[model samples]
Target: MELFNQIFVDPFVTMYELPDLLLQTLWEGFVSGTLYSLIALGFVLIFKASSVFNFAQGIMVVFAALTLVGLHELGVPAYLALLLTLGVMYLLAFSVERLVLRHMVNQPDIILFMTTIGLTFILIGAGELVFGGEPKAMITEELGLPTGSSDWDVFGGIVIFQHIDIAAAVIAFLLILGLAIFFNKTRIGRALRAVADDHQAALSVGISLNQIWVIVWFAAGIVALATGIMWAAKSDVSFALQVVALKALPVLVLGGFTSIPGAIVGGLIIGFSEKLFDLYWGVPILGGGTESWFAFIVALLFLLYRPEGLFGEKHIERI
Candidate 1:
């Protein structure tokens, strides 16, 4: 016990004693976690509608960011460039449905997953060729996002929070709300749910598979765009940003790949725990870089007890 205290427990106590920095770190983690959820939501939307895992969702984030910045670099207004980039994402949705989903309509899930993995390589090559492989500034000021920071005094300590982070958190919240409403309150949303429930049955009942695929992919595009903007504001837009997409795998595992609410809760859980662990234990024990792998490890441990996830549907298959 004494050895453990000397090595791990005492150091964490000293670190936690800094309430201001702890609060600030948690705030940052929460904001980042929300953005991760947005990206994961893209996977949820497409997976629900088409059962396609969309390995390209991460690169879609980078591609959207590049298109936005590229259009602005051509002298378009920031807002206009944003709108046009959205149009690009829609175009992608249209093309994907027409070219990929149409041909692979009745294919097995493994095949669809493979196709998406192939598509990811294609997107990576195309993005590098068209956008250049260098990291670019996100044009945060041009996008009209607030910058800088503010501080609040608590317990004689000042907690600093960034305005950009606050805006990102707010925007993520609104996006989640919009998606929730879209999934639960609208006609198209209902159609989406129906298709997810039974694709062959949906087609038999007169639902156009093409239209549903396009719409669901477009919704995913919207999610990709919002995630790109916030993440780009935080760090420069680059292929590196695509790696963050891997974070969504654990989020999906925790939230259930099919549940929107699951995505949100899972994202916050990963974000908070990773930050907490990194803050209190990473340095005193495992060096650092815990953020890179902590979420998956946590998810793996959780899976030992609940393989279906917190909100995933239970299986009732019987012979």
Candidate 2:
């Protein structure tokens, strides 16, 4: 009975008593979740268009950020370096489409998946070589991102907000909104969707598979750059940031690999739940360090009931 109370009841009491702390925790989770959604959005963009699981997406995040910071350190102006980094990412996308996806056309899904894994290793090696395997500070101030924190008094307590966190959330929302509009309202978007549905059919209709692939990959690269910037602002830009990319796996599992909105929703669910549980329940019961596995555990339990994910299409088989 005592254990049960601590497990199920004590956390609620703590929350009720420490509402300010609860609010703070939720805000932290929201920022982390938004970042996760941004990464997952890149995955969804590539997966929806290509049917290939781009394991390299995570590395792409690290590479983009590293490129941005490295360029800045080399005396390139911040904004100009941002543009140059986008150009590099675009070149990378074009190269991948030309050299990788071009040859892998007509291959099995597993083959395409394996190709991405290869791409991951190549990017990792190239990143370490060029970036010297060191962590770099994000140019938040140079880029004019807000810093410091704001606090609000509520319920006789104070809730604090970081300016960077607010900026990140706003940037994420704008990026997502822009992507949503591009995919839903643009002609190229229509062509991309057509290709996603049936590559041969899209090709027969005069859509160049190579062109579509380049565009989709470039789009994903752009998303990666944005994610890398926001995330690196929160921490140092390091190769280890790839772990943040790995966190997207559970988000994809929870939200469905092909869903944009699902990515956002799933990210929030994972971010909020993981932090809340880690702070309130997991640490208390498991002696801390539960955030590491919380996402996968929650996703696994959810998947056992709905393997299709929260928004994935159901695959019904006829007997």
Top lDDT prediction, candidate number: 2
- Per-residue lDDT, model 1, residue 131, is 81
lDDT at residue 180 of model 2 (Cα atoms): 80
Please provide, for model 2 over 184-283, each residue's C-alpha lDDT reduced to its tens digit, 9 standing for 90 to 100. 7899989988988889899999999898888889999999999999999989999999888989999999999888888999999998999999999997
lDDT of 2 at 11: 98
Q: Per-residue alpha-carbon lDDT of model 1 for 92-119, expressed as tens digits?
A: 9999888887899788999999988987
- Candidate 1, position 230, lDDT: 91
Where's the lowest-lDDT run of ten residues in candidate 2? 306-315
User: Which regions of candidate 2 are displaced past 4 Å?
Assistant: none
lDDT of each: 0.87, 0.92
TM-score of each: 0.96, 0.98
| Model 2, C-alpha of 26: deviation from truth (Å) | 1.1
TM-score for candidate 1, please give it.
Answer: 0.96
Off by over 4 Å in 1: 6-8
